[model samples]
Target: MIEQFFPELKRYAEDFVASYGYTAIFLISFTESIIQPIPPYPFIVSAPFFKLNVYMAGIVALLGNLLGALAAYYSASFLGETFVKRLLGEKLYLKGESLFNKYGFFAVLIGEPYKLVCWLSGIFKMPPLVFLIASFIARSIRIGAFVFFGNFLEKFIS
Candidate 1:
């Protein structure tokens, strides 16, 4: 089912990244980390084909994602736990709490488990410096993976 959308998404990502370069990749990565539905994978993977330097693409993506994660963290902190409980429902919220409590730092280190961890970090009032460092490292590594993939693809195709 997800495969059907790939071609169109690929085309759009290629065009946008080609036209805007690092700015487009940064924006996509930033928004995706916050609430945007379009993952930045397409942009990262298509970056080489779009004539962007792979290293620059990864750096831009990492910075954007870190900033966006910071935004979400601050927003959640401002909103507080009561708001989240209401938003996610009692059961879901509790489950998230449990997962975050168990996973701790690893939650942010790995992206898939990060949404709840990001929210809980704020709700629980984790130290900002800690959040920033962990988030930056994890996001950098994640985007680096994409950059490597693009490099590999570019080499293979050439």
Candidate 2:
């Protein structure tokens, strides 16, 4: 359904990323981790249009995102569930706690259900080394896919 919006979406993505360059990559990744509802796709897709190397763009996205994720995780862990309950209200925060308790690794995949799992892993206090490994896998998959499609994918598929 949303595929129909590609013309407008592509313009917005390309323009924003092109205008902001690498800084946009940092902001998108950073905000996605904590404050906002954005996913990392737009940043990744926009890289090619800006003449930025996709590999470096992906790495910038990863570093910024990881920092934001780790920060959010520590915030949640340090503040404790009680504070989260009070702030977000008991119902919503408890759902978050339950998600962490039950399907921890899988929950990592849901926030953006793609690359943005980095922040959730941090929020859940997944081990640093483990989180790093998980991030490597997730971000690698995203960057690989982004580059593949943006580069040779159309020819291969066609």
Candidate 3:
């Protein structure tokens, strides 16, 4: 688990959400989509604990992820494959490239290691419109599920 290696990161996320609310959600989600190792789920889950609106947090997170994905896409496009491969590492870059080659645009929908998919989409020159649409749909479903689970857990605990 991430905590085993980066305990401070977990506390920092919690503290960030507690201190900054929706802004924290957006930043956390955005960073996760781009490069942050920590996922946004736990931050979203902690929303209610901070008296934040879970549904609104989900929407904010979704928007942040969309923007971050776009940024990643564009970065890979302009920066070239070699730069991206180095940033993402050879193994991950190769794996993402493989998935994109195998699945085409649908790889964005697959959403495994989501950042890699975004980077690969750009590196491979996927149609921008298709990438955006697929990312929106996939991220909506993914964030919605996390919000639903977070809400359920909040209620269960309360």
- State the lDDT of candidate 1 residue by residue for 1-158, as single tens digits: 32366667656766777889999888877776666556677677767778877778888888888787788788889998888787657997787677667876766676364555567677767688888888988877777788889889888877
Give the best candidate by lDDT. Answer: 3
Candidate 3 has a TM-score of 0.93
Measured with C-alpha atoms, the lDDT of residue 127 in candidate 2 is 80
**Which tens-of-lDDT digit does each residue in 18-122 have in candidate 2?**
788778777777766665555566556545656776667777887777777666666666776565556566665566667767976656644453323543454
Residue pairs in clash, model 1: none
Best by TM-score: 3
Off by over 4 Å in 2: 1-16, 86-89, 109-125, 153-158
Give the lDDT of residue 109 in candidate 2: 46
Kindly report which residue stretches of model 1 are placed more than 4 angstroms away from their true locations once superposed. Answer: 1-15, 86-89, 111-113
Per-model TM-score, in order, reads 0.82, 0.68, 0.93
- Which 10 successive residues of model 2 have the least lDDT summed? 110-119
> What root-mean-square deviation over C-alphas does model 2 reach?
4.6
Q: Rank by lDDT, descending?
A: 3, 1, 2
Arrange candidates, best TM-score first.
3, 1, 2
Instruction: Count clashing pairs, candidate 2.
Output: 1
